[model samples]
Target: MKKTLRNTILGLTVTALFISGTLCGCGKKAPPIPASRLDFLEIEVAEQEKYIQEAEAKYLEERAKLEAANDSKGVRLLDTMNRERLRNEKQILKKQQKELEKLRQSEANKK
Candidate 1:
């Protein structure tokens, strides 16, 4: 009977130690996810960059074509349209650039 009581006390002491050890912060935390794996904004930024490049290229091509053509009503109309497109595209590019910056800022905040 004495042996049994000793063993029970020993077991309880071991369990208590274990519980206290676990309650004490072990200095272990889940590692932060790798930024490259977590980041989805990069893809969108790249796509927007491509779109901006293509728009600028098309505008330049149209301007060159206009410059080569003799001044006529149709040419004037096309130039006006091209100018509007350029303005609109520039606005879109600026907006997208701002969005890209915001995404970058948010990504940095996660670090």
Candidate 2:
């Protein structure tokens, strides 16, 4: 019984070491990032910013037009658009709050 227990413990220790060695051996070298890809990412980000600005401008312009119109359909459509904009704004505010909370928690952890 003593021999059997010793063998079992030894086998587990050996198995654990083997697994750790195997895991450590599997770290592969990362490929270098290309300069051209970095440039492409910058260009894409600029384009996206431009597109978002354009979209916001268009929505604001449409909203003003809706507000100016006094017709029933215009009023209904404006109300719908306003509701949607409010909903989207609420979601954005919530997401910003969450990000702020995460930043605060991380800063606290650092301190």
Instruction: Give the best candidate by lDDT.
Output: 1
lDDT of each: 0.68, 0.63
RMSD of each: 19.9, 15.7
**Cα lDDT for residue 40, model 2?**
44
User: Which residues of candidate 2, in runs, are more than 4 Å off?
Assistant: 1-70
lDDT of 1 at 36: 65
The sequence of per-residue lDDT tens digits that candidate 2 reaches over residues 42-61 is: 44445555655676677677
Scored by lDDT, model 1 comes in at: 0.68
Cα shift from native, residue 29, model 1 (Å): 38
The alpha-carbon deviation from the true structure for residue 105 of candidate 1, after best TM-score superposition, in angstroms, is 1.1
Error of 2 at 78 (Å): 0.3
- True lDDT of residue 68, candidate 1: 79
Sum up the clashes in candidate 1: 0
**Candidate 1 — which residues are off by over 4 angstroms?**
1-41
